[model samples]
Target: MSQKLTLEQIQNFEGKYPKQLWHLFMVEMWERFCFYGMRGVLAIFMVDQLGLTDANSNLKYGAIQAFVYAFTFVGGIFADKILGFKQSLIFGGLFMIFGNLLIGINPKEFFYIGITLSIIGTGFFKPNISSMVGMLYKDNDARRDAGFSLFYSGINIGALLGGILCVHLGKTYGWSYAFLAAGVVMILGVAMFLKFKNELGPIGDSPLLNIAPKTRKLRELGVLIGSLLCIPFIYMMIQNTDYTDIFMYTIGPLAVVYFIYQLIKIPDSNAKSKFLAAFILIAFSILFFAIFEQAGGSLALFAKGNIHPSVFGISMDPNVVNNGANSLFVIIFAPILGLIWIWLSKKNKEPNTVIKFGLGFLFLAGGYYIFYTMRFFSDAQGLSSLEVFSLAYLVVTISELCLSPIGLSMVTKLSPKHLGGMMMGLWFLASAYGQYIGGKMGASMSVTKENATLIDKMLAYTGGYKELALYSLIAGLILILVSPLIRKLMREVK
Candidate 1:
């Protein structure tokens, strides 16, 4: 028992961090390539290739994003209780690769099939990988936060590459090439993980102590079979908003109940305090994501329909500008912000977790308001300068720097060690709710062919932005007011 507990530490390199960090970093980079690559073009593909209405595209985007987040709960549970992190990662990556391949082969007929596969795959892959990262460090390890920051940068690097390359290929060549690129990169991610699993040691080992080998093998097989059986059901859910509505309504309460049960099971006050703080922060995160997620739904459509596709005399793809701008900014600013956080920590002047969340919401609101104000400058075609689009991403990226990485680190710090994977899933579930709402919000601004005058479309989108700005501002203020209390609930975590 003692040997198993100490395995990861024994393997740990004598450096600022563990050797496995780089391995996981590369794995995440390419996995994100698979994700954001497909994501960058999914909306436009639905609109252009399928001839779906604006409303339908936004709803489908929301539904797919919702499924992806919702499935993390399933993945996290299995990782914690059955397959362990390493197996789950491999399992998820394979599904994503196959799914992308299917989409590439015949998007029109197999679109839902491909999406269902990616949803299940991401569910298994995403949360467990983050849990594995958290497992690499002790609860009080100072390097954990910095490590996650670096990992977050890797995610953006992939996003930057995927956004630039995939969008250009999709637009210039066809959707098939873009999806094929996603599948190809996912294979690289899975290959990297397979080659580097040894560095991870027992960090993601199964939690059930001394379980029978035969029983464990059966459990793994059951999980695999069950996941496959879910595909048809997931495909049905993806095809319509009605099914997703039922899923969201059902899952939201179930998640709350699960968290409450976990909270009740905790035996220590310090752990309880940390869990409470995490719960409060997770609640506020929904608003942050609701606004921030517009980047993919409303903002993507806005760029495609309303912004010029050229900048500085260089022709640019709108999807590239839409997706790549944030990644470009993240790559530029993540290092600087990571250093800034470290510098502030040394001075004992770093902001608390709740304060960071508040700042995220404020920046998100401000970004939307910036776009809302630009409505006045729109031409008769309802088009705006590319600069406006770029600035929106800049402010939102700043907001993301404050919130996303901090939230990842915070979950690892505050969650009870045994429940790390489930906590990560809950964090993503917040994203699920926000994205579902974001889709509905975006869909509200839909412009059909009959009403599709540029000016009319611009007004609808700008109006939605104005509403989101107000909502984010209000949420930010509320979170800021309660920051001191939330910090106190974190006990000794910070």
Candidate 2:
């Protein structure tokens, strides 16, 4: 009989990455294809097909996204306490497939129902996978950041493909085809995980391994059934939007209280300090994503109504460019930036994690300012330059490179082993707040006047972007000013 691989052996591998990372990467890529594909279509589908006002679509989009990330916190706790990562991922994937299939059947009628299921599935799937990747490296592994960087690239590859394909399919073929494509690719991702999961050895195995087999199976079954039962409640909440607001307001404070409870349970003072630093970073991330998330909300509408259809001399779909451009830029530039970080680190000049995060906000400010500048390039028709819009995405991609992957690494590095899943969940939960606020911001930018001209929209949206740029600048400065305290709390983690 073959000896099972141990976690120690996996972490002690020679070379830049463990082979298992690639398998996870492929799984994540396909899942992201499903995720980003659905995300790229949600607001536009509501406005174009369901006849929602742009403001309502943006608000609904925010609520949906907020629910998605909030559930990750719930899902993470479930995985940590009961199901384990593997079962959570499989169960989540199944829910996502069914959700998309439901929407494909009748988009306008089933949109909320389908979206509710996808939210639950994404909640279960997203955080656990990243936590598992963190498990691949030892504490204090220098290559950990690099591993996450590579994994991030995999995410964008899936995003780029799904973003382009889903929007194109929805526009040219039909909404049914677009949603069905997302479902099919998700099925492939789940199947791929099932086939190769053994390569992960004991990494994501059930926490109930010590219990009786029948009991374990029953518990897992219960979670699956329980999640399905929440669909109707979620459906109703999504439809009302008011319920969404109430939920968001309640959840944030409750999560902070729970985090504090957890923090008090830890035995080490240094660990507690590190957790505080993580919390601070997580708080700042809310501001970053609030500005960044406009791509799926206000920017989607902006692309459809105001941006020119050509990039340089090449004619293309504006929605496609809006959906996929950032991912493409990330795929092309992430590795180059990763290498640059390595080169700088060799000479001991690489910025610390806190500074990197601060720089992300600075870059975000620059990107949004560029977005504001698009108004200057507009003609009498309010059709602005797509080339300049694409240029803004490129700068936004740089900001993402500076902060996001590093944030993932920082959470793992700072968190205790037992709290791994929850800390990662908290990171995404912060994103939930960002998405929630972003929706409101998008709605505020929406032109509501009946028979409003495109120029009116251009002015409103660009004016909003200018305000966002200023807010980003202030946040970046504050983060940079506070970096020293955070770095001290981090101690030897870096």
Best by TM-score: 2
Lowest lDDT sum, 10 consecutive residues, model 2, at: 337-346
> Where does candidate 2 stray beyond 4 Å?
none
- Candidate 1: list runs displaced more than 4 Å: 1-16
Candidate 2 per-residue lDDT, tens place, 1-494, comes to 36768899889989878898899989999999999999999999999998999999999999999999999999998898789999889989998999999999988888888899999999999999999999999997777888888888878899999999999999999999899999999999999999988878888887889999999888888888889788888898899899999999999999999999999999999999999889999999999999999999999999999998998789899999999999998888887777777777778788899999999999999999999999999999999999999999999989999999999989999998888889999999999999999999999999998999999999999999999999999999998998898999998876
TM-score for each predicted model, relative to the true structure? 0.96, 0.98
Superposition error at 190 for model 2 (Å): 0.7
Best by lDDT: 2
Candidate 1 residue lDDT tens string, 1-494: 22333664633547555777778988999998889888888888899988988888999999999889889988998888898888999999999999999999988888889989999999999998888887788777666777788788878889889988888888888888899999999999999898878766678877654888888889999999999999988899889789999989999999999899989999998899899889889878887787788777878888898887787778887678898999889888887787787778879898877888889989988888888876886888888878877887799889898899889999989998788888898999898888898889899877756856888888889898999889988988998998888889999877
Supply every candidate's count of residue pairs whose N, Cα or C atoms clash at under 3 angstroms: 0, 0
